[model samples]
Target: MNFCKGKLRKLKQAFKIIYRQKSELAPTGLNDDLQADVMRRIRRLGPLKSGSNFLMLFEQFVWRLAPVAMTITLFFAIVLMNFDLIPDSEIFQLLYHESDDFSMIQFLRF
Candidate 1:
């Protein structure tokens, strides 16, 4: 029982030493020189040029337009798939043509 108590006390002391070592090694704050170097590199790069700015603008435009474009494309696909459901009108006649053998593929080609 005494030997077991001595071993337990040693283990507790070892754990405390480890915890103190870890806390001492941990970073307290950022180094000023490292922060200054990062800022210096950013300054050297400067602002974006006209071409880069235009490219960024174009990217944003495409991002905003993609969903709308996809929705319109999907709507057209659905309508085309159910072309027979569309009421016969001037627009339909113009699109489908008055020919007895009207073909969607041929119309699309034109």
Candidate 2:
């Protein structure tokens, strides 16, 4: 029992030392640099602080426009896929007439 306890204590101490080493090796300055950069960019862009009414209107506009844009994109994609399914004139002739040559009727359709 004493031997087992000693082994557990050694493992715990080793884990603690390893954790401390890793923590020390990490870049401590990175957090401060990241925070400063973010703040600087925000300052350059200027705040959106045109009173509460502007924020409310902007939020409503985003909510309304998002769905409309998505729906328009979906419709265009559907139409494009349909046109793509209609084979080229050469391939269409083969399927329609089971012949390699293009007929007068097919030319008239074009």
lDDT of 1: 0.82
TM-score of 2: 0.31
lDDT of 1 by residue, 1-110 (tens): 45698899999999999999999998887699988999999888887786599999999999999999999999999989988754547546866565657666666564
What tens digits encode model 2's per-residue C-alpha lDDT throughout 1-110?
A: 45698899999999999999999987777587799999999898776766667889999999999999999999999989887554577666675787557665775586
C-alpha local distance difference test of each model? 0.82, 0.82
Number of backbone clashes in candidate 1: 0
Provide the lDDT at 27 for model 1: 88
**Candidate 2 Cα misplacement greater than 4 A, ranges:** 1-50, 85-110
